[model samples]
Structures are given as structure tokens and as C-alpha cells.
Target: MTTSTGQPLAAQRILVTGGAGTIGSHVVDLLLEADAAEVVVLDNFARGRMENLAEAEAVGGDRLTVVTGDINDPALVRDVISGIDVVFHLAALRITQCAEQPRLALESLVDGTFTVIEAAVAADVKKVITSSSASVYGLAESFPTTERHHPYNNDTFYGAAKAFNEGMLRSFHAMNGLDYVALRYFNVYGPRMDTHGLYTEVLIRWMERISRGEAPLIFGDGAATMDFVHVRDIARANLLAARADVTDTVYNIATSTETSLKGLADALLAVMDSDLKAVHGPERAVNGVTRRLADISAAARDLGWTPEIGLSDGLDDLVTWWRHAAQPAVAG
Candidate 1:
């Protein structure tokens, strides 16, 4: 498969930080499919699983190398980043985790990102593609938020970390001429989603309840909305960003479609063919961003990338995967 720029990924030495996670693993698989010369995965296993890289290992053979390491270790990061053509910096704590552990968030998201940027520049990597988040647009003032939107209202530690990382990338580009692209992902859901997490997405929680023939729960009348983009589409966006000539800019990677909790529950019920209705509960104290919809025109115009999977189709895929995978018990 050719990159978005129609250039083959063949013989390219790529490094994927957090490559064993959901979206990162998908990127590894796609990179291997594109016949990258060497795909090295550096993951500390904080949230990543070894099983996620099973398929890539089987298919990649000598082309793939899995390194058990931390991105915060400057020596380690520099060592692994050396001789790499492109770097995909995806390692970070979850949003909830970051909110709970501010110090860890600073170390992992802030310091770790600094290590990545410094190493990538020192290594003279062709391009660095990193994962940003829509959380940066916390409590957005406008709908269909664009990349140009400032992170003025962002209150969460996670959003602050992501915003800082983006700024660091731009600063590095200016000072060290480090080429980079940050993809601000929205609500990402698909196979390999972390259903066992303490702060899981509503989709995962609802699915677990529905599987047990229990009513799905929605918080605060289910008015809060998000832009749910599929993991596969996110992985594709990474590849497009990696190959595109764009640099020192951020792009929103989402479906450009808003989905409310109530709508999501209904869609999942229909997809799973369940008769259970959603139950409303008190709202949890979390990031209070009530609405999320992205303007993906920049990604489309620049990287030539657009989400191919609709919410319905993506939900069907998730449901299928959930049925076949182990169903872990989740707390309500």
C-alpha cells in the first residue's frame, strides 16, 4: 500500500511508541502491510498488551522488533530512535489516569514527550507523527471545532499535557527543524478497546451491560455528545500523516459526526439486537466537555484522509469483536 502521497513505505525504518496498544498496534499492522523495512515498537506495557502485537510479530517476522521500555528514559528513547526514519509518538497515560495522577501525567506526557522530541531531532528522523487529542478543545465555544481552535477552556491535566506536547513539537520544528504532525483524535472506539479500565468510555460500559442482558446506563439525561471515530480510521490517519509533506501543524482526526450518549446506546442496542433500554443516572464528575464534533477538512485537504467507517458500521465491528473476545466483568 502506498502512503497518502503515493509513496511506498517500503524500506522505511519506523518507530512506533506505544505500538502495542489499540490504535498503535493497528498502525504497526498497516506499516508491516506496507512492507516497511523495520518497524520497532517501544512500549512500557503500562497500558499496552503483548497480545496486541501477536499478529504483527507473526507477519512482520524480522521486519518487526518489540522493545520493552519507557519513553521517559532519555537514554533508552535516544537509543531506539537512532537510525529511525519516522517516529510515531503514541505513548501516554489515559485521560482519566492523567486526571487522577497529575505528577505521573507530567512525567509521562510532558517529560516523556520532551524526550521523544529531543531524540527525534537528534536522530534526524524524516518525520514524526504523534497522537494528540480532542480533549484539548475542552468545553469548546463553537461547534465543528477546527485545529485552529485554542485550548483556552481545557481544564484537564490530559488536555493540558497534549496541548503542551503540540507546542513542544512546534517549538522543536522552529529551533531544531524537526518535522512533525499531531493528529487530534476524538472519541476513538473499536476492537481492543480497554473495557476493563476504571474510567472506560460509555460505549464499552454500555456494551458490557447489554451483553449481560442488563439495561445500559446513561449519565445526566445523556445529552453529552462526542465525535466517535473508528480505531482503524485513526490508524489510517497516522499513516497519512506520516507520509504527507505537512509539518509543524495539527489535524483533527474524527468522523465530523456528533453522537450523544443516548443515541450511542440506541445504536448499540440495535446493532446487538438487544431489547434493553438505557437507564439514566447521576452525572459523574469528569471532563465537562458536553459537546464534541471536529472539522476534519484540514486532514482531508492536507493528508488526503477521510474516515471511511460510519458509526453504525463501526459499532457493528466492535460488537462482533466483543462477542468473540473475553468478556471481563465491569463495575457499574
Candidate 2:
């Protein structure tokens, strides 16, 4: 669980909101494995599942404590922040959900941010690493998107929510001297991704389709692409952000390699050893990104973060997990 640099990010105590999620669970596992003294996981099961923490609990033993609660509860957030050295804030509603219920979704994000950041500042927590999204770069003006091109590229409620979170963090830092970092994660793919959503990650849907002997569905032309970083890599980036000597800045957490939907389905087919071809579907998205690839140079230079799993290796791990996850045990 030590970083790739071999340095342990051992903490006396840690609090991870949404800790029972796809990426959050991996963050918990890595934190426990890296020898954190104690870790408290808080989740409401809105989009989180207890099964996601089974492996982490098995490894962490008494060192891990799970709490089921709402992140929007200011008092609850305050209580959870007490005596914690670090916080990884991953609680959120999905973009599709945000689009459907903008009022509730937006309120949840704004309310949750105030609760977590206020509690952290009140408790004098050492650092907080928050979850941002590459969707903030809607229709990028250039390839290799960087943090500087944000607010302009923000075109979705989901993206705006993340950007608002970042702005709050900066304001907190400026006013109260809160230490924080935000990672703008790109299209993350791996095991345990939420499989029930209508807009579930294309890769997960494709895997399920292949399992059912159905052809993978391609929405856009087979050419639109995204930077699909593994969830494990995303988890590792959080650790790096927590342990590194940087703050009040954002970093792009991605592999910087774009994979077309066709390429992804082909990769999955190859990995699954399936011969099924992808079926073409109507251009489903009203305003979908045609391409996105991040510039991870800042993460590398600042936090010593770089993705270790290549697409094929990541796909192999994902397929293995998917095959075992035939039931809905893990969270999104």
C-alpha cells in the first residue's frame, strides 16, 4: 500500500466519506494496507454498498470502522471529522442523476461540501483530498486538457458542482488556512462500478452485454474517445495527493491515453475471449464529448503520481472482477 515511490502514507486517523463506493473502497483498502493507524468509512448507501468494504474490513480488522449516514448532515459531518488527520471526500450524485433532478442533486453537493469543509476546518484536520471530474472540461478547447482550462469547459451541472466544490475549497484555504487538494478524475473504469444505471459507464454495460451473449452497444459513432483510468489508479492518486507536499491546487488523474468506444469494446472482446461484435446504436447523447485526454504532468511532477496499469492489464483485472461480480454485491 506504500506509494510507487515506496514511501508509506501512514496516518494516525483517517475519514473517508462515501468510503463504500467503487473508487472509495479501493482508497480505503490502499490506506489500510499502507498502515494507517485507523480509518473510518462513512456512507449512506445511496450509491454505496457495504459489500464494497468486505475486503477492506477483512484486511484492516479493527482498524476500520464503517458508519452509515448522510453527508449532508452538518452535525454528523462534524462528529465524524473529530480527531481525524486526513479526509477523502468522495460522496456525490452522478451526472445523469444531477441532470434529472437538478435542484436536489445540486443541493446535496453544496450542502455536503459546507458540512465536510466546515467540519474539517473546525476540527483542524491536516488535509482533505476531494473528488473532481474531467467532465468539468466539457468539449475541451484543446487536447491534453489542463486545470487552467476549467470554468470555460464546464458545461454540465455535474461539472459545475465539482467546480463549485473546488471554488469552496480555495475559499476555505484562503480564509481559514485549510489544507486541501482536488483531483479531476477522467473516465474511471474498473471492477465494482455501478452496473444498474441507464447511463452506466459504457465499459461496464459492454461487459454485461457480452456476458449475456449480446453485442456491445455503441451510442456515438465508434470513434468518440475518452481517457479511461483504472479505479485503482484513481484511488492511488488520492493517496498521493494526501501524502504529497502540495495543496490549494487541482491535478488531473488519468492515463492521458484516449480509447475510442470501438477500441474499448474490441479490447473487452479480446480480453473476454469473446467473438461478439459491437452493435451500432443511434447517437444517444444530445451533447456528448467527442474526445478527452488529460495532461497528467502536474500530478506526476507535484504528487509523484502516474498510472501503473495499462489498458489491457486494467481490462484483465476488470473482467476478472466482473465475472466474480455476477451479483450486485459491490457499489458503483
Candidate 3:
């Protein structure tokens, strides 16, 4: 989707908390593509890149504004929320990294969420859509986990934080008049996803190893599955949530299909045009029930949003971008 030369955002002032990360940047892009009046990006640059902001600004023209700040800062969050029509809060420490730093995870995920909701309510923002995660469902006994699934065992601090935040969202919606939407995103992969050393996403790690003619590493039985949804589809869902007139609610934003690690390895090999296979490594023991996929029927019915990008197509785009971005000329 392309925005007009100017006035891409038409008139609504949309604030994207953590707007410079992988998923958040795409949300900013889609919001601008819809021609919102203004797109305010709030980021601390702790885990986000400057280029993500630059990309948003380039496409947003004058509509994009970057606030280099932390979400935990109530003052800054309130200031950004003031006069904004909608808030897409996508800021948080990720799952793997949060596991290593449990305390920081709680601060950023749980406390930061409370901060955003409070600020949004204070600013009287019309709508708020915070990013949730499928991790909230720890291990699903069923194949396609629905929103009605039993509360998670909370295998990690990250998942526990999300669970706590979901409770907070419900509380805010009930007591205050804050309209909110919590989207439980599945395994998201697309362009601009994190590939930092030892902090890369699983799909990204697989792609990088395959690019270097190395066999991808797999832990456990490689049978555990995840419903991988593309960031573009997630971006569209965020826009839909903001535009739709709805009360506080939660929805699973995912492709509604399960892809196991073995399958993912095969897909990557096909993408890279390589014959290297996956090598089983020492499986890190993780607590929690396994098997996860999203039952997104509620999302389709309520938000009129469904992820259209398939894993293969999404991974293809991601690998292509990664390959180009990995080149020396492109790097500097």
C-alpha cells in the first residue's frame, strides 16, 4: 500500500509505542499508508534501531514524528498520548531475551504495559491496541488454541508478564472507560526482524545459517509447532483494530496454522536453494506445555482481520531482504 505525497495519515493522530521495532515499524508503515493525520513513534532505542525510524519518516513525510523515550516513563508516555486518536503499543522485551533478564522483563512488559494504559486513559486516547503474545498459552493441549483456552502455566517470565498485563487491560476497561484491544500475536516473521548476535529470532537464525552453507540447529524433537504470522498481516490487524469501533477486548492475531521446526528447516532450505539439513543439538529443557497455534475465528468475526501471508511467502520476503541487507555495500 502506498500513501499520497503528503497527508498520508489524513487527520487522525496515531501514536505507535515502540514504533521502531520489527513489528512496530510495520505498524507505523501501515498506519501511514492509510493516511492517518499524524504518526507519533515512541521508542527508547534500547532494542530498536534508528534506521527503523528513518524508514517510517521517509514514508510518512511530515506525518511521522519520533519520540526517543522509554515507555516506562509515565510523563513521556502521557505526553505522547495526549491528543492522539489511537495508540498501538508494541513495546516490550521479547521472549528469549526476557527469559535471560526476568526482572527487566517484568519491568518492561508488565510495568510498561500498565504505564501505557494509564497514560492512554489519562490522555483520553480513543483507542488502544497493545501487542500481546501467543506465549500466554504456554503449552496448549489442543492443536489450534482459541482465546478461550485455559490460562497458561507461564513457563517463562515473559509469558507471565503478558498474562499479568492482560489482566490489567481487563481491569482498566472495566473500571475506566478506556477502550483497548490486546492482540496475541503468533510467531511473527518479516522484514526488519531482529538479527542481532545471540538475539536473533529462530527463523532469522535458521536463514542466516543456511545462507552461510551451514546446517541449521534444532533442539528437542523439532516437533513443537508455532503459528507463524507475517508482520505485514499484523500491521493490517493493528490498523483494523484502531479503526474498528469496539470495546476493550483481546484477539489472537496469527496465521491459524502450525509449522514445526522440521518443516521450517525444510522451507528455509528450499528458499536458500541449498541441500544442507538440520543438525540436532543439545535440546534446552524448557518448562511448559508444548504445541501452539491460534484459533483466530474471533479476530475474523470482530475485527474483520485475518492474516493472508503464508509462511513460505513471508519467509521468502524475509530471506530476500536479509540477504540484500547482509551484503557489504548495503551494510555501509
Which runs of model 2 end up more than 4 angstroms from their true locations?
1-8, 197-199, 328-332
Clashes of each: 0, 1, 7
Candidate 1 lDDT by residue in tens digits, 1-332? 73232234679999999999889999999999988999999999988887788889999999999999999999999999999999999999999899789999999999999999899988988888999999998989987899888898999999999999999999998998788899999999998887676766777878878988999988788988989999999999999888877888999999999999899999999999998889988988776889999999999999999999999999999989877874665575
Query: Model 2, range 1-332, lDDT digits (tens) per residue?
Result: 62221223585699999999889999999999989999999888888888788899899999999988988998888998899988999989888888888997776787787789999999998889999999778889888888888467667888888988999999999999888999999989888887765556767777777877888988767898889999999999999898887889999999999999899999999999899998888887645678889999999999999999999999999989877864632322
> Any runs in candidate 1 off by more than 4 Å, and if so which?
1-8
lDDT, candidate 3, 1-332, per-residue tens: 84211112357899998898988999988888788889999988777886666666888889999899988988888888889978888999877789899888877888888999998888887778888888888887776788887665557788788878888988998888677788999888888887774566677777767766778888877887878888899998888877665666789999888888888888888878888988888778754445677899999998899888888888889888887763212110
lDDT of 2: 0.87
> What is the model-wide C-alpha lDDT for candidate 1?
0.90
lDDT of 3 at 11: 77
- Model 2 earns a TM-score of 0.94
Instruction: Give, for candidate 1, the lowest lDDT window spanning 10 residues.
Output: 1-10
Q: What is the C-alpha lDDT of each candidate?
A: 0.90, 0.87, 0.81
Worst 10 residues of 2 by lDDT: 2-11
TM-score against truth, every candidate: 0.96, 0.94, 0.92
Best by TM-score: 1
Best by lDDT: 1
